[model samples]
Target: MLKKVAIGVDIGGTLTKLGIVDREGNLYAHMDFSTTMHKGFGDYLDELKNQIEGLRSQIDFEHEVMGIGVGAPNANYYRGTIEHAANLLWKGIVPFTDELKTRYDLPIYITNDANAAAIGEMIYGNAADMKDFMVITLGTGLGSGIVSNGQLIYGYDSQAGELGHVKIVDNGRLTGLGIRGGLEAYVSSTGIKRTVFYLLSDMMDDSVLRDYSYNELHGEIITKAAEDGDPIAKAAFEMTGKILGEQLANFTAFSHPEAFFLLGGLAKAGKWIFDPTRKHLEENLLPFYKGKVKLLPSGMMKKNAAVLGAAALVWNHLQE
Candidate 1:
């Protein structure tokens, strides 16, 4: 029997990843490239086609490429377009599926990256048995995917589950979308870096983080400093977690999910972020919600999770 696989594509502001995944969740021929290096979306698509053809040449076994699944910022599953994605260079609504159709005559699907992560969890990760859960992607920005009663809530406009953009404070940090006080502005990788700088100004503590400039600072640097017991770095995690945990509690009051899986670079901080977030979540939860919801790392953390999640869209759609 010829093996069947789906081509998964995850497009980010900085990078684009591609992988071939089988029904059994086995991944093969995965690769990534700089998305920003391309001059335009059309150029990017040409390179993507070339990359796909190159990937297929690497496989020695017999296989059938079933479809293409794409996870992109601001992707609309209903419309098959990426509309006004603040992170991408593309300005207007780009007919993503239509573009792909011109290249390959295969079933194609698209959704926001976070939503893809949630579906990937259901089909290939830890949430296979759970009915209610949330997947929080904490990278360049925060992205959320909310699943209630075993269904991914796309809302009326296919724009629901934007928990990251929910306002947390008035006159707070500004986001890429020019929105002030959005949760992601203060809880994402960039958010924690801002927190570090904020603490640098308010609290006069002698620390190693003071040595690095704003451009030099990143999640890994802060995580390393925290691990080394730097007060400023540790304090940043504490503050970021506290805010995120409080928001999670608020989300709980509404949807009441069984768990919230944290993914991406900031989540790699492990105890520094998780401990405080868990503490605040418990402290802020309503009486009935306390100790009921679990905060866990993503099961797909070690793998090309985003890629798998994108591929899962193909398997998921076929099932329906």
Candidate 2:
């Protein structure tokens, strides 16, 4: 069968990724553009329209657009809207899906980045056969996508899964869920750094990290140190993984997902994180579920995952 080429757009706080894809999740041409703040909260759709059109001319879609799919921060799939997204510089609700439809004259699928990532996994990654699973993204902040019944679970108003904000520690962990401790507080690189700063401060012994400002200390630096077998860095990653793993056990009671796909900056910490995560998850999981849930790395390539997800959403929408 001739595959229908679909366009996928992934909009983040600072950047946007776009691509042309097919039902099989094969992406042909991909590009990126900046997301500049629009003046007076006006239409940034014009820019997107122009850019997509410009790309279409170069790529030459054989079957025309099957559909257009998008993944954005605070996106509502059910409503086809972008709400007040933090760090996205938009004051009011933006009818992004509707705006794109008018320009492209085709079906448009819009979802939050987390949901899109999950969809991407369904079509392009390891979860193709699993109806229930979760994709956890660890970066500047944390994000998640839930899959149930071989479909993306777009909850009421499309805010179904915001696992990062789920409170883990009693009282204020740091502002996630208005409480202090949460999954994000550990798994997120930002959270790891905070813990690192506190750990380092208490050490009373100077280390290489002492030279760098906390703001300047990034996930990569810590990761490199861990690779070199630095005890502090390694300990930080272990603690992070332990926290993440423990929470997965808690969420499993509700979702019964087969596997949890971990992605993004902190996830790459590898065994330093995964080992502890596995151990902790095993410790807390229900006896029957203990050996069931697997902590797997995201099969989707980091750069391609979001765009592929956005495109896969359109493909999924068409099939539905």
Instruction: List the global CA lDDT of all models.
Output: 0.91, 0.81
Top-scoring candidate (lDDT)? 1
Query: What are the per-residue Cα lDDT tens digits for candidate 2 across 29-81?
Result: 88887786455334567777777777777765456778888999888888889
How much RMSD separates candidate 2 from the native structure?
1.9
The TM-score, computed over Cα atoms with residue i paired to residue i, of candidate 1 is 0.95
Give the local distance difference test score of model 2. Answer: 0.81
Could you tell me how far off, in angstroms, the CA of residue 264 lies in candidate 2 after the best superposition? 1.1
lDDT of 1 by residue, 1-320 (tens): 78899999999889999998987678988999988888887888989999888898888888998899999988998999999988899899999999988999999999998999999988888888998999999988899888898888899989999988999999988887899999998998889999999999999888999999999998899999988899999999999999999999999987899999999889998999999999999999999988899999988788798899999999878876
Which one wins on TM-score? Answer: 1
TM-score of each: 0.95, 0.94
